[model samples]
Target: MRVALLTEGGYPYLTGEARLWCDRLVRGLEQHEFDVYALSRSERQEARGRVGLPPNVTGVRTAPLWTTDDRTLHGAGPRGGRGRGARRRFLACLAELAEVVCRGTGPGPDSSDPDDMADRFRNALHGLAELARAEGGLVGALRSEAAVRTLERACRAPGAPAAVRAARVPDLLAAAGLMERALRPLSLDWYGDGALGSADLCHATAGGPAALPGLLAQHFAGVPLLVTEYGVRLRAHYLAAGEAGLGAPARALLASFHGRLAAEVYREAALITPGNTHVRRWQERCGAERAKLRTVHPGMAADRFAEIGERGYDGRADASGTLLWVGRVEPAKDLVSLLHAFAEVRAAEPGARLRIVGTAAEGREAEEYLTRCRALAARLFPGPDPADGAHDDGAVSFEEIGGPGVPDLADAYAAGAVVVLSSVVEGFPISLVEAMFCGRATVSTDVGAVVEVIGGTGLVVPPRDPGALAEACVALLRDPARRERLGAAARARALELFTVEQNVAAFRGIYLEIVSHCPVRRDALDEAGEPVPFAHPAEAHVPGRWAASASTAEAAATPSWAGRETDGRDRLKGAAV
Candidate 1:
């Protein structure tokens, strides 16, 4: 079966967190053909370009979200991008969208009810979508003065929130621009009978525009959508509101817009797969139905860590007990609390050492934070010593083991007797997983999915508490047998749940299940290039049907091939019980 894998700011983009996972998923499932739909967030990311894709990946289509000049679609005489009727429709859609956003999304007639708000959002969204398809584009209209005026009226509308009322002209312009950028997908030529619409299933690797194409594919072609979210895109949008320096009004409206969009996506999707329970919980809280949610852990290759794990522990967790902390150096890593905890660890066990080994993340602030961490480390465990080792020269050694001297993630994990994750904010705790793969016992703060990931395989401490963190470290440090046992268990758990093989197997099953229930959308073509949609055997064309032993209720929930080939016989025959 053909899968349209969708992504935004990631996947194929060389420097994204989700890129590696997407590559693994696509490569692992070589039996299925994939067409990638990617949205780049910056020129730098676009310049970095895509990594090599598998042979099964038939094509890659990309669009920029960085900058869009309105003039490109403007300056058309009387009959330009849209005619008068289409222009009116675009304006009406924009007005309704701005209104729905300002009123907020939730339960009461007050517009806070997500269900009610979702209806309004969907209606407005489809209205704009229809205009884009019919008029050729909405870029010019979306950035026009007409769109700005519609937003102003919405902000001034009778029931508008105080924040909306407080929006000045500058704020209106900012919000309008933000909305236009967010909705740019409506004008893209990626939709229709030939593009995303032809795919058997649209699989979005992330949310937002990554899933937006899937949403459109379902809307336009009746194709089933399987949206896989490693991170909750809506929450990221909310956090990004602050990072982008958007005003309160703009941020609130944008948040509501994303919330309504996510609800509609969850409502329409055939299934929603989250990489972890932490991501799952966020989807659940965002109006995703419990019936539709599935947890699929992101896959990681375990072979690289195999060598270190094979010779792990050595029956002694007591070689001065080096405490290792690894991850991008940022304020959120809570390196401050980690330094304090290490001080306490030093007080208890004088010979105990802490080695912080990782580079700072991108940004001048991360650099500043690293400087502060170094100063704190110097004051806490002062002076460089000759006996520290070839790679080290201080009580608290800050080394870039990512270099040629001590390369490989396994080496970093093996350097420590106890792996420590001190992040105050985290997602999936990749470092903790890496440590597990290296067969090292861990002590991670209670943040993100650390507690869930540990699963009794490691000690957990509350975040931002040096005292609690210190105690956990000391307890594990003083006990070698418990540490070794936890290390072994952690490695076993990682291999079982998070390995490339297990992740591939889970998704392979999910892909088969989704395809089995839904009929393929690709139309069979004759020599004249005439459309012979569904001319292929209903069961034979159905991907994974050959080995699909069981079926889903979702299969029979809707007519498998509506508006096209399925008569009653075909529908019932395609249904697998």
Candidate 2:
């Protein structure tokens, strides 16, 4: 079977979130062929290029979402792009989409009923799809200054929100710019018969713009779509809205657009696969059918962790009652809270020590956050001889990846009986899984997929509650056998459920199942004017059973002698007649 893997802003990108998982899926399942249709979010990402690909991947097609100028589909008097008449059709589609979006905000026929809103969204979607085909694409037109002015007029029209009405010319330009990037998929050529239409299945690695191509493929080709969401893309939009980088009105509009798009994707998909139950819940909340949802944990290579876990606890838990925190140092990690909790842990148990070891990624802001965490640590636990491997106040210690005191990640977990994750936000906590793999008991905040990943294997505390975090740490610190038991269970669970082999096996079955229900058509009609069947038993294809090898070349090859003999027989029959 052949599959079209659709992705936006990731997958082929060398270092993005979904790249590794997609690479693994394609390489692990060598029985089927794959065609990757990727949508890039930025020039830099496209410049970074793709990950190493497996041979089974037959083709890779890409379109840039970075800027409209990169696309050339919108010019009038085009040399066979699209007729100038197509502009009216494009504008009509845009008007229909804007109307639907406006209604979806609160006043549509289905505003009160989610089912009704779904129907409305579908209608507008089909309209946009028709425009995509009729107009060649929206890229050229969307990039035009005229289009931005048109959108500005709509936003400032009567009944527009107070914030939207206040949007100036620059705001309209920014909004149009954002929309051009978001709707870049409308200009893609991936919807036709030789493209996504020829694939047995369309698997989108995530939602939002990445899944838009898959949506179009299904809309035009009768292809079944499978959406695998490791992180809830819509939720990320909402979170990013809080960071103050984007204008409030732009954030509002964009979030609504993404939310509606997700709802549509979920409603149309044949199946929704979430990397964990946490994401599954988000899908469910966004109108995904319960029957259509399946939870598939993200796979990790566990062989290294297996060796460490097999070694068991390196020493008695009671003797080395240290707390370990490992991951990139960022504001979300809540290192300050971790430090406060560590102070409480020290107060409760003098033997308790906290070791934080990880480098800050993402730039100067991360560096500043790390500095704040260190300063907080020093103030809480001050010491005159800070050089002597002792905390300034004998409570908390901070180090980097290869520092003499911290060494490596696995050793950091080994240094403590308890592994802690204090992040206020997360998608999936690889650190918790890593600690589990090292057979170290965990105390983690309930964020993202923490509860689901932990699955009762470790203690989960609420985020930002230093007291609860401290209590969980102190509880585990006091009980060595309980810690060992939890650690053992965690290791067993991670090995059984989260290994690369298991994830691959789950998707291999899913691919077959999806294709078994919805197969792609590659053959044209036969001379009989009937649809040609693709696969059949060899014996069934023969007259008096002339079965050949299952090779296409052998099936189509006819011997010269056989042809000559048939012609002579036909001539003899004609003469007799």
Clashing pairs in 1: 105-112, 106-112, 106-113, 106-114, 107-112, 107-113
lDDT of 1 by residue, 1-577 (tens): 7788888888777977588888988999999898887777887887886798889988887776666643432221112344666565667677778888888732233536656667667767777665566555565677778888898898888867786787777777877777766776776767655567778789888777677778766766667789888776788888888888878877777777777678788888889999889989888887789999999888888899998787888633358588988888888899999999989999998888887778635788898888898787777876774123333545687666566525765776776899999998888888888889888999989988888788999999899999999999999999988988999999999988888888889989988777667654455777999977656445545455433321243233222111111121110100010
Off by over 4 Å in 2: 47-49, 71-84, 106-120, 133-136, 153-166, 316-318, 384-408, 524-577
Looking at model 2, residue 450 earns an lDDT score of 93
Local distance difference test scores for all models: 0.75, 0.72
Writing each residue's lDDT as its tens digit, candidate 2 over 1-577 gives 7889888778777856788778888989999899988877777886777787889999888776655553232322212235544555455545545544544433223334666656555655555455555444555566566566666665666776554556566656665667667777766656766677778789999988878878777766567789999998989877765674667556555666677889989987888999988898899878899998989998887776666788878665448787888888999899888888888988899878777777646668897887787677778877643224443345566667777765666667666788999999999888888888888889999999999889989999899999999999999988889988999999998888788899999999887666555432345456897876664223233332212221332223222111111111100000000
Report residue 431 deviation for candidate 2 (angstroms). 1.3
How far out, in Å, is residue 269 in model 1?
A: 0.7
Q: Model 1, poorest ten-residue lDDT window?
A: 568-577
